[model samples]
Target chain A: METPNPNIKMWQGNVACAEGALAAGCRFFAGYPITPSSEIAEVLSLRLPKLGGNFIQMEDEIAAMGATIGASLGGVKAMTATSGPGFSLKQENIGFAAMAEIPCVVVNVQRGGPSTGLPTHAAQGDVMQARWGTHGDHPIIALAPGSVRETYDMTVKAFNLAEKYRTPVILLSDEIVGHLTEKVEVPPIESLGLTDRKKPTVPPEQYRPYEMDSSDIPPMANFGEGYRYHVTGLAHDETGFPTNNPEKIQAQLERLNRKIERYRDEIVEVEVQYTEDAEILVISFGSTARSVRRAVINAREQGIKAGLLRLKTIWPFPGKEIEAISASVRKIIVAEMNLGQLAHEVEWATRRSKPVVRINKINGEPITPNEIFNAIIRQD
Target chain B: MDYLYYLRQDKMPHIWCDGCGHGIILKSILRCVDKLGWDKNDIALVSGIGCSSRTPGYVDFNTLHTTHGRALAFATGLKIANPKLHVIVVSGDGDATAIGGNHFIHAARRNIDITMIIYNNYIYGMTGGQVSPTTPAHKKASTAPYGNPDEPFDISRLAQAAGATYVARSTVYHVGKMDNYIGNALQKTGFSVVEILTPCPTSYGRRNKEGNGVDMMRYQKENTIGIEKAKNMSAEALAGKIVTGVFVDKEQESYLNRYNEVIKKAQSGV
Candidate 1:
């Protein structure tokens, strides 16, 4: 293992993401260039090969996703980075990785859009899409980072979660945090807590690729490991063959969902600051959380008690945490770049116990601290 | 006699319909593997969505049935990640030429060390006879009921043009020849393509004027001309006939080989 360099240096968010993936033991990267996310690909292209890892610039986003899944199956930690339009194209293969239970990481450095709305600007419009973008009821884990340093830490968390759960994890970033340059301290490789998927314990003849024990996460046998098995996107039995049996289908779907649901507390992470005695609570994530912190500080100085709830794990939506905050605060303010996407989730979790107000921006710009401060002070 | 060792006995009664030629192609591939004496664990069978894609289910090897038209893309990743493992992709006409057409050409251009066998039945068999990219003009399909107007793609020529190091074509009736071609493909160090013209009897035969499985076999035997013979035949005489032989065979560095060179250069800090 290489010694950790304690030297602090300025780095872009996307560059930090690539460094973090390397620190987390990602050995294969397949990506197609898309704005606000290409730096991760560009840096990895130069860096991965030197480390004896592989980097492939695939023909398109669809191929990039496919290649990442394949590399993961081959017993290497793999990842891909893309933006809005590319993320849309990757949905089908993302669903494949979900059904096949392949471990991989996907970083979507979000740009504005329903379709290429703004290639170089910031937007958190993909929050709902990240959770339910792929067509199915499969479980997904997505992490949102608030700063360049958090981008590095969350990317490492993303790979660890993906391997521990044996599923694909998404690192959701908007253009603001992705492009922002900040001072980051590079941690030693040994300091990062890296996790790998559990390998099967049985002999080759008795191995079943998807057979679950008490943990619900089946051991994944790598290809060419002498335990030959089949994997498919079709609803399959524990033996990993296509099955249309209603009972088997129900069991398979339940296992996929429950693996994450049962361990939601461990998989979900959030940053809660000054919320214990505050009357007003601010809910924010990703690049917008940076401004929300500033807004909360300014509001507190104006004699209004305010706190910020920054979501680190955006999916498996920290409902328990939100419920506790809703019970304590008088009003909940949700600020994001998109038009009230996460606000609806806050409302759903609170069950209307408190008023949930949304401060939305959709003109391809980051939500500024001043804008959030004004929203906090408004009487309505 | 020991051929059954290659199969997963529990997954018997494969989903391929009776008289379908996918079985013959699968058997030929298995024979090639046996002939080469490859360890089963070292081979990864990959496929996309089609009747032909169901092959990975019956074969007792590390198999992946990926999304539609992306088997080659997936196989490319598998091969690059572990260069020692042999990756083979089995795809149908529509799966290879329509949805996955871009991946097919790109894989060829990179010359990745993968053997891709295209089962060209000229129609989308799994979806009930939709007009595929290789569906012959004037053939009736569910999607093209009134004498299809689309021209078909010559897969062998297309693969050769796209830079596959080894390219060959053979029909189901030419079983021995297919085994030979597949064996050669497996031996090649770069991207190798073997286009197998198979029969989708239930979906394609009844819709066209072709009679039955046996009749389709007879048509294949009668319509295909050897490449050597094709050289002497007039253009008008060989217009509808399939030319069966190797189109391109040469040595070139594959994607993994070139990538390893890059790794060495980058690591040297030169």
Candidate 2:
């Protein structure tokens, strides 16, 4: 008298992330164990070695990021996952990858923090820190997903963007997304398009490590391929040598910054719902987007015309789309776990006195749908 | 021949001041690597931000130019990802032993297979000749124009005490000996540091009235005693003397070797 349910399955967001990384050709995972992100490292530690991939639990977050960069150089798609305090500990190495232009994925399943705010609770306080935590001026590609399915999809995309741009791409998940259990289909690895970093086509003797021919990304070659190039944080010339020449420094700096800026349209990918004729708009990312979606539905039932702009890509700020929406919408409400982080960007993008309301709760807790609805109602 | 052929020459001639000892130390490093005949692909170079940390740009290798005081962290990652590659780090005194002092000690304690080459110019050269942890006491620098009030770091001692498997010190003036010491350190199985006492001729030299690169080299030549002699000397006798030689050489399993043991033990279902 027992019947198995064909459509039912159980998997946590962390497992989905691990499986998605495997699907994305991630043969190397270097991460220290931390919660709620620890499940990712735990599953990866078990699964990676079985598949002939490398999984190393480094001593700390710094070493974790460093190992991922190293494995990427060895021609493997590599990634590392961590939570709040670990993410803060990893900024220096993440910035290193940014400056060196190493292609890799860093998954930060954010918990509350200025410093270790919440280890187990869910919060999105790292929204601003993800963009500006690293020292110096550099571009970052960050993705946030509200659901387990999106975590898998976005983790794959994060790898692709990193490879395409030759920069570190961050997957900004919160504890809610990383630990929430849901059914996810693991696609056959070959069905997905995985990107390996571009190696120089020229002979090792003729290669220029950081010189771009036409594409924004310069051709790169890994170690043991015989090609060699230096990487430095200092402003350098096309050949990647350190320079003090103001003109060369300026050119290098601009190139580093603009390589991502010029491709903003291609870089930014967002999900918009009911925004065409909306008077009030809700902007949110990560797990907060789920609450915003619920709030949008609640606002509609209350006879208020509300829409949701769920940021799938959180960096390069999506200025054009945000600007376009701000011009047409009467009010913009930003819902996040931190006070006035993405709200600052919204204000900057709108330029005008756009009445942008912030629904922030940073006591290691997520903002509920009621909070988002109230914030919108207050603005209304 | 352009000795720096592998260097990103197009980005040069370079930003180092005239008569700076960094150029000389860099040359020695490249020469050692070349002479060893190791494939450039098998070598990984990492550096933190500073005047000497810029050395990674001149060598064609798998390279990472990381944040200030964190080259050790990046190099540790590189070594862990593929322990087969020879990982080396080039850091400034400030970058390696000051701001990044915590990472440096931990790497040594863990005995990771990384070679750290510290360019000790006694001052922060790139940031304009400020006093550094390696700056001798009472020495005048841009930040300490009146005289450095802080005690100087005996870097080799600190590293050895931190559990580094191999540690050595050499000056830019001793190019031949430096190449030998550096080569041996690179060949060592675990964490090693070669504290290259280079001269910041433009800043440190000018401030201290050492005349130029030549004068700085002469000062080093006269002040340094061999490690054997240093071992027998009293603190008063060794007061103005710099010791140049290998201080620690021992065998211990590196990070990777220990990790492999864990993997092996796990595979056996233990």
Alpha-carbon lDDT, every model: 0.92, 0.83
Per-residue lDDT for A1-380 in model 2, tens only? 77956434577888888988988888789888888899999988887766666687666788788778877775678899998788888888788788778899999998877776778988888887789889889889898988888888888988888998889998999999998998876655665677777778888767877775676688877765666666666666777766679987777667777889998898798888989888899998988899899999999899888999988888978877888865788899988888878888888888856788878888877788998888777835
The i-RMS of every model, in angstroms, reads: 0.6, 2.6
Top candidate by DockQ: 1
**TM-score computed on alpha carbons, candidate 1:** 0.98
Q: Give the CA lDDT, 0 to 100, for residue A365 in model 2.
A: 73
Cα lDDT tens digits for candidate 1, B1-270:
376999988899988888899999999999999989999999999999999999999998899999999998888788878888999999999999899999999999999999999999999999999999999899999999897899988888989999999999999999989999999999999999999998888999989978888899999999999999999999999988989999999999998899999899889997
> Candidate 2 — what's its lDDT?
0.83
lDDT of 1 by residue, A1-380 (tens): 98866668699999999999999999999999899899999999999999999999999999999999999999999999999899999999999998999999999999989898899989999998899999989999999999999999999999999999999999999899999999998776777789999999999889888886799999999999999999999999999999999999899889988999999999988898889888889999998999999999998888888899999999989988988865878889999888998999999899978888899998997788998888778876
The 10 consecutive residues of candidate 2 chain B with the worst lDDT sum are B1-10
Clashing pairs in 1: A4-A188
RMSD of each: 1.9, 3.8
> Which residue window of length 10 is worst by lDDT in model 1 chain B?
B1-10
